[model samples]
Target: MGPLYCALISQIAIILAFAIIGAGLKYIDDAFDEDRFSKKKAISIAPIIVLIWICLSLFDSVSATILFSILFAVLLTGKIDNLIFKVSTIALISILFLTQMLNLLWIPLVFLTLMGVADEKGNDYVDNHATLKLVEFLFSYRFCMKMGLLSLCILTLLPWLYLLAFLAHDGAYESVRMLGKISVAHQRKKKHTIAISPTVNE
Candidate 1:
């Protein structure tokens, strides 16, 4: 009964962590709306999301955790508009690959490359100054569509993998502290939001 109770609590905490991550990403999405998708901001979010996945992996199926990492790679690579962006994307991919290997790297690489190329080509729908328009369009439709699809795939696979693997085993209490970290993050965001709102209002 104690193990079951801990598992139930841990699962709820995991779900809430994901919900907070979604909220945090939605905050980024709002920022993207304001500045129209700054490449630097987008690149930075990738590692943060990956860190979240790494934390979750402690309590999730190996397959689901790996899928999360792959999706992180694909989504992060979409925002690359400069050398720094490419380098960061490559570094993250390499880390994930070296740590997790081919089973976890190949399919995401395929999706990343395909959707990235498509984004490069779909630059005609946003603005008029050719180069600027291309940048805008890449962020507007192509990145959004491709990343959205990949996120959908990750969400779809999570439950089945969890059931099959039964990751909420006895060691789950070891991971509950992750929820505290996420809560701290939320508090930080709240403080930042409060700090910035006054300036914006002024």
Candidate 2:
């Protein structure tokens, strides 16, 4: 209906694209054996994908930021395997987190969070700092802009909301992978014990 609404749709389009790509990467990894195609590595490229997206952001900030957030969420969810950590991290970032664009600055928080990433922490920090910048508009703007601000926050939080759903999903794939390892170990032990008991029966 207007430029603002058009911008909203464009950002949504980018967000959907990242979601589809994230899903496609997972499916591809699942289709192959772990040795042939590591799902970890597949999702690991999420940062690179996002870095490239950020480069494209210069041309379209709104759309680029929205899409990057979605992919970053997918990447973040892939790395962290704790519910309480994710929940607590989200709460803190929603309230206490801060970021800068020109310099890419954030507080030194070592807690496991989506806000950062490093070799030691694995997910130390995200390249995008504008994650919550639009929060001001939602509360500080005039009545005329209330609808627009509401729409922006909803769009901005979509990636985060999606990650929450993924984390709460019916047993994450990592858990299933761990179970598979345990099952193999259990079967091997059972067979070994049976083989040893026959020799002792004599």
Candidate 3:
């Protein structure tokens, strides 16, 4: 293939990898949250996921790398409570420091991280308290980050393609979450059936 074609393929590969890794991270979190797996298992797998995510971010351009690193750090620190996640995030932050990835784009980082935090908090609130359909729908899918990224793109602060990649990551994360919910429901149904089957037979 020509160099252009090769470069296109490489970009596609990176986006796909991000999607898969994002899904894996969500799966582990969902497993723990839904009681499908032990906290120990989630903790054990978190470091590997964090490491891979950091390594992949390095492959992007410097601007994208800094954005990804800052956003990732913000989300991890602001939302996650697990000890392993906190430790991994600290390590990730240290990597950013050592590599000089932390730059003077603090304003944008603050804006994006605030959007991320809003999404996280809004999602939780909507899940338990929100009654309006539109409100629930927006937060349920975590649209805050999407909007923030789009704003940045419109302002020429970030490339448009990064928004698409972020969508891919969010899409994969939601898909895994939905599948996990279904699996948990199915397991509950199966156990209920099994428990009553013997009485029905008797």
Candidate 4:
């Protein structure tokens, strides 16, 4: 198949994976509680998220795509309500930040922060503390994950951007659908961390 077809299939698979996981979480809310959290439950979604990452990562250069996908997976692992997974994710981010393998460390930092917010919502808890209130004050409700996906999509299209510019055409509009795939991976990973963050008390 061609790049367009490959990209299309990847987008569909990523969307389905995230939708399945989201439905599962909503359907089995109690299963996520401390008493019921198990290795089986915590790990069942790991492979699925990884698969989505792999699928969507196909849109860019192999190394960059895979690296970005790994970052997304690491972030998603934190949503399992397992300390080890969360810590590992944080550690990986820190190492990458220090190593400078991943550009724009602030991107992951902001990504993690947003994940923390979403995870708190997933636990059916809203943090209304003075600090959280301050954070909420600082950030708008425009959905950071969406913003990140938009950035990723735009970045992925850099080559196409130049091509379009050279061609002096309107292919950019045609590229919007590509965002669906990238957004699925980004949003899924973001949601997992967001659902389990600490509540800020005021």
Candidate 5:
């Protein structure tokens, strides 16, 4: 294959890797939240995942780096009470600073961070409150970050490929979340059925 073809393959691989990791993380979080997974196991596994995520970010473009950092920050903020999340966030931040992956232009970083925070808050609000269908759908998938990234791409401030990668990550995250919800519901139904079933005397 030509060099161009090789490079394209590499980029696609990275995007797919990000999608897998995103899905895995979402599954872990959901399992833990539903008490299907123990805190000790999640805590033990978190650091490894954080390290892998940071290493993958290094292979990605600036846009991905900033977006991932914003995502980590949002997660930390939301789960401030969780020890594993706090440690993971601290480790990520420290590594990003040490590696200088976060030394981007301040204006865009600030703008994107604000947009990300707004999206996180809006998503939570829409989850609990009835709202317009369109607004709920947009926030459900955290479209604010996608919209921000697309605007930057249009302005030639960011690469288009990174935006596509971000979408893959978000899509995988959502898919895993939906599957987790379904699994939880199925488990509840099974338990209810067992509870109502009459036992046979041996």
Candidate 6:
């Protein structure tokens, strides 16, 4: 009935939406060949991701939160194995990078580069490369979001942790939960990728 309640509900819905899509992604990747998702499966999941994006659009003004969520959805669509979706995601990121945040261009650039490494597994050099850079950047971004949320929480405090105050804290970083998370492919193939990636004579 109130703003805090509304925020709490919206954030919960957002988390559930991401989690559901993430789980669906697991199945999609596992049950089929790489880059192959059925139209039925895609049909079921697309609306959920789209709905979350819409909700996030209305809920938060934080650029990182919105961008990351859309990025995640784009990643999921790629798993759908549709070239169109992949191209659309690329176009979306390019538009964002070139047009929206000049200062933040490096963020998406690095993000896309790191993502490319997963596909570059066969190449000895790329596979041998450590994920320290990507992980480090992710941790840095996570830290920034944490600080942003903390400051928002402190500034918007309402009489010792009322509903509004708690919601305010949660509200600041919409993408907070996704920070430092493993993509579906990385989670599924980490073992093989890591072990064979370093070998020169494979």
What TM-score do all the candidates reach, one by one? Answer: 0.38, 0.28, 0.83, 0.35, 0.83, 0.37
Tens digits of lDDT, candidate 5, 109-199: 6667777887888888998999999999988776777888789889988778877877887889889788777777898999988877765
Which lDDT values do the candidates have, in the order given? Answer: 0.49, 0.39, 0.71, 0.41, 0.72, 0.43
lDDT order of candidates, top first: 5, 3, 1, 6, 4, 2
Candidates ranked by TM-score, best first? 3, 5, 1, 6, 4, 2
TM-score of 5: 0.83
TM-score-superior candidate, 1 or 4: 1
lDDT value for model 2: 0.39
Q: How far does residue 161 in candidate 5 sit from its true spot (Å)?
A: 0.9
Q: How would you encode candidate 1's per-residue C-alpha lDDT over 1-202 as one tens digit per residue?
A: 6998987887676655554444434334433443333447655775675566556643454433433543454464464444543554566556656667434434443454455455544543344344575568455444643453456357663344232222232123213334435655787899999999989999
Candidate 2 residue-wise lDDT, 152-175, digit = tens: 346563234333322322123344
Candidate 3 C-alpha lDDT tens digits along 132-169: 99989897776787898789889998777777777787
How many clashing pairs does model 6 include? 0
In terms of lDDT, model 1 sits at 0.49
Off by over 4 Å in 4: 1-7, 17-39, 51-126, 130-142, 151-202
Of 2 and 6, the candidate ranking higher by TM-score:
6
Question: Candidate 6's residue-wise lDDT over 142-192, tens digit each?
Answer: 333333334434665212222232233334332323331334446658777
Q: Which clashing pairs does model 5 show?
A: none
Q: Which residue pairs come into collision in candidate 3?
A: none
Instruction: Pick out the ten consecutive residues of candidate 3 with the lowest summed lDDT.
Output: 61-70
